[model samples]
Target: MAQECRIPHTVLCPARTPTCQTSPYLEAIRRQLAVRTRRLNDTGALTPGPPTASGQSDDPDTHDGPARPVVQLLLCRYLAEHAVEHLRCVAQTRHRHRCPHPIRALTGPAGTWRLLPTGPRRGQLALPDVLMAIYDLGHLPYRGQLRWRAQRCPQHDAAPGAADLALAEWQPFDPLLHAAHIRTRLPHPEARRPGSR
Candidate 1:
């Protein structure tokens, strides 16, 4: 039987879940974005866009925008839906076996987002920056570039001969050939009231 999805607002079974095999990593990214969005909003660092027809402010957390958090979330979703295999360690052991470890940091959000000091005076303010800028950067890398950079896990990263043992054949990823998972739309804010199913 397929596994149950624990992701909020999602109802798909494992077979139909796009991130079923990689939900942990994707969830971490999502949580980071949500937290950052909240922080920025609270601090007034991010200006709310014009109100929608329903008079609700456009929430950066759920809407696509030029903001860093939204862009990062979108990038992560694209990666999760298309190049998920790249999210795993690609290093080859001396025995010609692929590393079993995942490429994502095991320490969750803190491991991905680190505190960084940045301001006009260089010490006036501290902000969180993505550890590797992989998912946080606004620009997406060229095709296969991320996979090449994330080829090894922390343990096998510097292992001698690891690169030499890499598999020779590599298949290109084609999103069209894969089954796309259905994305659950977030309900209207009013529908989230108590006793509202």
Candidate 2:
């Protein structure tokens, strides 16, 4: 028989707990860790959200375009506290026979990187001081701020690969490049080429 899950009022996720994919507690925390990327997208702080095509490069570094106004918010202590709160709630709902949701106990030293934020912006920095302050706390584990750059993704020719299979690599969505590719491939554009005209 399995032992009863006697979770505490607060689930103590230690610093050493493995990442979300490996640790059950961290996994639960991951589910709750919504970075609010959509909010950033809506404000034009980022080019756009995901759902990239398989053949197209998703790497932000490959894009060669004017930079957009962007900001990054590093969640430090806030992340840990949030995880604790979430675990506490899950613990409260644990079953008598066994926890319906198993929370792997935190062990070892704390990890440095719980979460890292990265995205592009459309224009100048316009965040209010109060809101920035919350993210800029001294005690926080991670640090970030709005930064400007010309190209979100550096342009590069993709190496030939299995055309039918998606590459096993991270890619940044470059809407500009995607649109340009589509524009070039259109049959109407080919018919109006300089030689034909």
My TM-score estimates for the predictions, one after another, are: 0.27, 0.15
Report lDDT (Cα) of residue 185, candidate 1. Answer: 25
What tens digits encode model 1's per-residue C-alpha lDDT throughout 1-197? 99885654332322134443555777566567677776655443555556799975554333222112111322332223222223457677667777776544343221112121111222333433322111232232432334334444556655545663444222322223311221112222332223222
lDDT of 2 by residue, 42-67 (tens): 34344422427774434332222111
Error of 1 at 44 (Å): 17
User: What TM-score should be assigned to candidate 2?
Assistant: 0.15
Worst 10 residues of 2 by lDDT: 145-154
Best by lDDT: 1
For each candidate in turn, give its C-alpha RMSD to the true structure in angstroms.
Answer: 19.9, 26.3
Error of 2 at 15 (Å): 23
Q: Residue 100 in candidate 2 has what lDDT?
A: 28
Top candidate, metric TM-score = 1
